[model samples]
Target: MVDKDATAAVSRSEEGDFVKSTWEVTVTSPEGVRHFPVYRTILKVPPVVLRLVQGELHFESALEVLHRREPVASGVLAVGETLRCGDWELSLHDRSGKSRAVLECFTDPFYSRIWTLHEQVTRVGRPGKRENELEIDHPTMSREHAVLSWEERGPVLRSSGRTWVDGVAAAETVLADGALVQMGDLLFQFRLLSELVLARGGLCVTSLGSFQARVHGELVTEKAWRTQAVRWMLARLALEWGRPVAVERLLDEFWPEMPEDKSRNNFNYTISTLRQVLGGSEAILRATGSLQLSPSFLGSHDLVALQRTLRVEDWGAAVELYGEYLPGCYLDWAVAMRGSLEQQVLQGGLRLLERYEASECWPEVLELGGKLHAIDSTCQRTALGVLRAHLGRGNASEGVRFYERFREHLGVELAMEPSAELAALAEQARGG
Candidate 1:
């Protein structure tokens, strides 16, 4: 009864117990606004399925669900260069090409990827589309066998298909290729390997509690606060909302009555908590200001969308959407996603520089420059700050030269950490 013309079937027993991954990215290029479908393939020769225990997309890099590094291949990546990956494509490049922002994959694509959850760069698909991305775990070896009622389980790439994580059934639908999943409308599909499955698993399967504690950790250390009030607020937010929120916005929303000056200091205390958790070294917080959101923190998403919009502030919808109203712009969410100075530098510098360039007032440059410099000294522009640190003492010329280099790459200098060769060239440019 063998149907001829079909290739020799490899039985499930033959395919080896493992998984294969494919990345279906919808990129919004700087030039074109449409979300183009770009794909990357992730495959490892057999035995272990890409058992994503957990996965998250952070400012610096992508951390997997499992502790292992899964195989990944993408032209849009490089070492040390970190860019946000999700519903929209985002990346940074050195204008001067001195060195590109890193596209680092900590676990060599050759090894097994670990698991952890993070923001999904790619959005979920609409109903009725072939799985745009899927990892075939427990791959069937028998080529002849049809996928007989496969069990969808566990966490997958934010948008990957037919997965099983801790026996949870999580899935998204595509309209021939769409990303619209309505929980209320879903037909009890949550029987297994779904959101319900995860929720039900609770403390045992989900890391919500630990992640909250981590959020507080990020706040304290980075901001270096001197109080417990912010932590208390954070706990309340996590309890009320399902996630941690930005501290700044939290203050603005909840502490609306607090004086502005004190609010700033207290907000700082909140960020301080985050720092204590993540440590000050990892470049995890670059995008915190935007990552941390609350009822008032919607701006993070809006700000990002603005980056894609052709005409900013054009319509009533845009006005209402981008935090034009005060009540919707909370900052605690940023506190929740605390990361490193490198991350802050990338996020803040890009944002401020964009605002500064588009702005009518050049006077604000001083303030903007100060804030940018604080995150990544290179943004200090023409300030002597980076030079003092670079040369181990104050040196005006060195600082000037440093700025020249910084501007060449970042469009606006923060503070320079140029290599010896680049510094020499910078000095020459300054002299000229």
Candidate 2:
């Protein structure tokens, strides 16, 4: 059930709410050290109708006309009141309401672009001086990499170069209605929007990797949040999603430096602004002396997802989802939460390393070991796992080199010597 008003708002823009996207944020720590979060942006590219070459005409004619920028008869896109764009003859109701296609190219949580699949065979590859293909400006992309063709079943992708569908290498794969395609270093999602049902009304908040809040698939832009206080309030509540925190507790966490009377006034105003930005009173609920995000409005939070993955010992998924908690935020609550989650991810990485070692999966062990080591180089277990992985792969010289680095790092950083076990492993590597 998409919000009609929100969808209407989205339809009016070509790039959706990204015109005023949140790009970067800076926050100072309590100790006065300023932190700048890496650049990221939220994009809500709208879907467009997918049209084929009109009847009895060769596809080349349509292609030539489209290249010439001549207006064709792309129909009204009905996802939001039947909006029309370009001349591709696309509409939500076109082809029995299955004519919409969305190609979303995402580099990270912060950067993304969306394009409609209009051509019969959409060429994808590195940009050329005069080539008319979907040119991906990535170092890893080849000159003529792949082709995406519109078929009766759906969008079919074919590639001989490096290509992956849903993370598995594939030369040719018939893309599902919503398939994740990775070419070179960029990721793209192909979706037949008309064939998919809209999400049930809820607030989907993303805080890890990037910050975005979507209501029933409609993005809540930063402009809508007129105050930083309001954004902070929402983030705090989202951290405790569905759980109530005493109003006093929130006041203490957010404004411990201010006087109670002034803080309370600010808190009340922040809450009002938050509810309005989220679009209704039901977004936040008040009862007794506590505040909570209404459970019905909470959906697919990244932090919650990471916690669940950790609980189930899904180390790989947990590691993939882990990012700087509340980037650019040094607020007290955010700091505490960041430390707690970082420790969890660090521990999970160690466990995952041990699993990889046990299975003699040297590559996975090395990859995961490097990540854990970056987090905490002093962790003996991680260093040992990495050393063993290097040795297991028959790279004894590499193992010895890593050991030398680790031994020196430990002595200089912690004024400690490597344990006897680690020394013995290095000796074994030396002998080999």
Q: Worst 10-residue stretch by lDDT in candidate 2?
A: 53-62
Clashes in model 2: which pairs?
Answer: 41-110, 74-89, 77-82
**lDDT for each residue of candidate 1 in 1-432, tens digit (9 for 90 to 100):** 111112122212211111111221222445443211111112111111111111211221222121123333222333223333233243322222111011111112211222211222222223233341112122321112111122244222232334322224434321111111111111111111111111111111011112123332222342443344544444334332223245456667656788989887766666565444334412122123422212111111223232222122222222222222112223463334333213533453445445544553344544444444544554333243233333333344755655665656554443335556546644644554
lDDT of each: 0.30, 0.64
Per-candidate TM-score against the hidden true structure:
0.21, 0.51
Q: For candidate 2, lDDT tens digit of each residue in 138-247?
A: 78788788988878876788897788886689898898854667777666656555421333237877888567788877898879888777887888988876566789
Judged by TM-score, which candidate is best?
A: 2
Which stretches in model 2 have alpha-carbon errors above 4 Å? 1-198, 218-227, 408-417
